[model samples]
Target: MFFTEMWERFSFYGLRPLLTLFMVAAVTQGGWGWDRSEVGAIVGIYASCVYLASLPGGWIADKLLGLRRAVLYGGALISLGHLTIGISGLVEHKLPFFLGLIFIVLGTGLLKPNISAMVGDLYPEGGARQDAGFSIFYMGINIGALIGQFITGFLGEKIGWHWGFSAAGIAMFLGLIQFWLMSPKTLANIGSEPSRHPDPAIQAKQQAQVKLFTGIGLALLALVVILVATGVLTINAPIVGTYLAYALIAIAFAYFAYLFIFGGLSTDEKKRVVVIAVLFIFAAIFWSAFEQTPTALNLFAYDFTDRMVGGFEIPATWFQIINSAFIILLAPVIAGFWTFLGRRNVNLSSPVKFAIGLGFAALSFLIMIFAANVVIGGGGIRVSPMWLITFYFFITLGELFISPVGLSSMTTLSPKRFVGQIMGIWFIASALGNLIGGLVAGNVDPEKLELMPKLFTTTTLFLGGAAVLLVILAVPIARMMKERKGADQPIDPTQEVPDLPKE
Candidate 1:
């Protein structure tokens, strides 16, 4: 599972640094030379969709495909997606490139949440051990990312963009092959089947509903695609992205409402769900800032940062590896810190950790504010690479606080039956963040260098305020998260309703 995730991330991060760069590059340089705003909007939408798909992907795992099968199918699609992108470079067509992104989004949706759920399944008695395990798993993710960004970034910049994309595809294929060979032996019964009702008649009805909705959804998607392909539909990507930000908020609210009003969850479960919802908002804020590394910051490296090392110019894409490198180095220390605290019964609650994460993310942008001012003061002269390195280091620290810890909390807190879906919900926070980050990246115009400091300042203030707010709320939120004596026991459907404490 670790290797699979590692390779998957390799494919993702490898291509990520290239997306905006390729679109904004000149035709002579094997790029389309699209406007920055258009590229940012498109990339933002694409990145968000990659995570947004997780909701349905998790549902499919819980209902139709089972986690293992979903992962298998997803890996295949991802490999194909990368290959399609590679082919696009050779053919020099827009259609294949767009199609490739769609394929990857779909594949990631299916694989991301389900795979994480399976990891949770590995340690049913979830606790500090699970947190440590996830940290180790996270190391796999960064290792792949670090190597992928180094190699793919070099290939894309020095060779051809498509070649880097092709390398990513090949890596995913290798991961898929190894997973196919080893999963049966190593995983055994884990994620082997879908969770289904025991009543055959009800199960059949549920299956039929799944098929019906799936067919309708696919047909609608095909219609939209066909219309767009034929030029019957015109898209203002930035405008659409602005609307999507609102839509994401609405969707999250509706989903949580449905869970509270209709889902058969106990009072304790409801409280944890509320806590998740609070964390969800804060997590979205954190991601919106952090995800800019591939867009706003990537552009910064290309345009404003000095990359000359001993007179050999570094690839701008190489800077993408800094975060992953930090993660690989620091994950063990953070994991051990959590375990040490856990052993002493002094570990920080998830909410408190979230606050700290937000604080560090704010600090990262604070550094960026200074860097942007340097550019303004230097009359657009390139600044040292230390600016970005310092920013990534702080943000990586923030990520360690939120990401693995949050994953552990989701698995441990959710009702057993909804683990996969809850995991999907967690990724939704990322989806929201990516969407906003992309939009923010759109405002980064090299022609208007003065806007850079303003942009960084706005981000810093927003993040700092959120951090303070979360800090203020952390104690009450942690109290809400405290489990009752029998909270870990299997919930019995036949049990009577019990009056619970108010929120």
Candidate 2:
């Protein structure tokens, strides 16, 4: 599962560093020659779609294909999407490019959520070891990301854009093959079948619902096609981005409302739900800042930062390696620090950790303040690469503080019946952030380089203000999160946890 995800991320991240740059590249340079705003809109829409797809992806896995088959299908779709994009480079029309993105979006929606769910399934008896396992899995994700950027970034920039995109396709194909060969024996019993009600009547009802949904989905697809073909519908970057943003927020709010009004949750569960809602907002804010690395920050590396080191010009994409490297180096250290604190009975609640994470996030932009000042003071002279490196380091620190903790809290705080839904909500926050972050990055025009300082300053202030707000509310939120006596904890020393789902 870890390797599968690593390669998947490799392909995903590999494409990201190239997307905006390729969109805005001149015709002679094999790009669409779109403006920065357009590039931002495209990238933002693409990213947001990827995360948002997880909602239906999870639903499909649970109700239809089961995890194993869903993963295989998803991988195939992703590979095909990459190939389609590769083919688009040779064709005069832009249809293949957009079609390719559509396939990738659908495929990722199917794969991403299911794969992580399988990871949790690997350890039915969840314990400290489960947390350790996920850390290892996260490391795999970073490994793929680092290597993917190095390889694809080089190929895309130094050779041809199509070649870089093709590389991702090839990598994903290899991952699919690897998973197919090894998973049969290794995960024979895990996620092999759909989970369903044992009762015949209930099962029949579910089957009916699934069929109804399938018919509705197909009809909607056809409707969209007719609309597009007849000129009744038009699609562009901003329009798409705006709609996706609105839709995601609406879905999140509707889901929360349903859970509160109809979920039959206890008062304690309701309180925790409130915490989750607050955390969701915080998650969105953090990701909006963190996700800029692949868009706005990528542009920074290309246009504003000095890429020359000892007279040897480095690839702009190489700057991406810094964040991944920092994660690999710092993750274990941070994990160990948490463990050390845990052993001493010092519990840093999720809200507190998140607040600190926001601070670190702001600190990354704070470092950039100096870098931006240098460029402004020098009248457009590029700053040293070290400044970007420092910024990545601080942001990576913030990620370490927030991301893992956020995942842990999701599982711990959620009601068992809605655990999957809560996790989906978490991803939605990421989706929303990606969309907004892309817009933020799109505004970064290299020609108007003077705006860079203001951009960095704005990010710093936004992050800092969020951090301050979290700090002010952390105590109350943490209090809400505190486990009430005899609420969720095991009462007897030898009895198994009540909510542990049977295999």
Candidate 3:
């Protein structure tokens, strides 16, 4: 499972590192010749849609075909999406480009939730082994991320963008193949079947529910395809068309959530839903700043930063590796720190973790501000490359605290039935974040170089402040959760579930 996930992530991040460049490149340079705004819109929309799809992805897994099928389908979609990118690279067909992106979005939606769920499924309940497995899995994710950045960044910038994208697609294919080949029933089980001791009538009802969700996933994918109609809506459609697609998806999300939140869930489940929504919103803010690496930050590395190293010019995309690299290096230290705190019985609660994440995010901006202040050169000015690396060090710490922990928290706190759906909402926050990041990136000054720090700082400060606010709010949220779930731990150890909540 770890190796399969690694290769999949390698493909995902590999393509991600080059996306903005691909969008900005000219037809001759193997790019789409898109303007900054268009690039922002496309990237923003594409990334956001990918994250948003998770809700549906979650539903398909938890309620529909179970974990196995969800991962398979999602993996297949991701593979196709990569293939679409490769096709676009060769043909430069505008509609194909959009089609490819749509595939990628839906593919991610399908794959992400199920795969992660499977990871947790490997362990029973709150055993320390579960924590260790997550740590290991996350390390694999970052390792894949680091390699993807290095390979894609170097190849896209120095070789060809198509090559990088093609490589990513190929990696996805390989991961898909491996997962298909290796089905470990017990190796790292994400979880067991939701319920098996049911009476025949109850079993039938469960099967019916699962079939309904499975149909919904298929229908949703089909609906998007129809709207896109590879035959009709080329990339030339009005921006409203894209907006409408998103709106429809949002409505679907609301509709499904309405069922689960109202009739399908307990009061505790609804509280967890609200908490997940808040966490997702905050996560959006984090991604808006951090996700910039691919788009806004990638451009910054290329256009603003001085890439000279002993008179050598580093490709702009190489800078993309910094965050992943930092993650690989920092995860253990952070995990150990968490363990140490846990031993002391200190609260490492979700809201507090998120708050620290926000604060750490703010501190990273301060680092950037200093880096910007000291930059050399007259026009845009260049800082020591170390500054970017330094900034990533802090930001990655913020990530370690928030991303994985938040994911675990969602699975932990959710009702077993709604785990996948809640995870989907979490990804939706990511989609919103990417969209928000693109919007923030849209404000980049093409003319002035010095303003880069200021732009980033403006955003970072907000994240930092939000983190503080969340930390303050965490006390209450955690308290609420504690009161509700004082002795009601997960009933099914295999479910990988967590708390009741008011957060």
Which regions of candidate 3 fall more than 4 Å away from where they truly are?
184-264, 267-271, 370-377, 448-454, 489-503
Candidate 1 or 3, higher lDDT? 1
Worst ten in a row by lDDT for model 1: 494-503
Q: Which residue segments of model 2 deviate by more than 4 Å?
A: 218-232, 266-268, 310-312, 487-503
Q: Give the lowest summed-lDDT range of ten residues in model 2.
A: 494-503
The C-alpha TM-scores of every prediction are 0.95, 0.92, 0.85
For model 3, residues 1-503, the per-residue Cα lDDT tens digits are 67767877888778764777787777787677777656766677777777778777776566555777777777888888888877876775665666777787777887887777777667756456666677677777777777877887787878888788878877878888888777764444443243342487777786687687667876876776677665554454226435744673475468447845574677676666666666766776787777766777677676667798787789877886788777766766776676677578665667777788888877877887666556524556665677777777788878877787677767666676666666677676667666655554544445655566677778777897888788788767766666566356433221221211000
Best by TM-score: 1
Model 1, residue pairs in steric clash: none
Residue pairs in collision within model 2: none
lDDT of 1 by residue, 178-283 (tens): 8899999999999989999999999888878878887887688788888888999989989999999898888889989999889988887888788778878888
Please give the lDDT score for candidate 1.
Answer: 0.83
For model 1, what is the alpha-carbon lDDT of residue 224? Answer: 81
lDDT of 2 by residue, 372-401 (tens): 778778777777888999999899888877
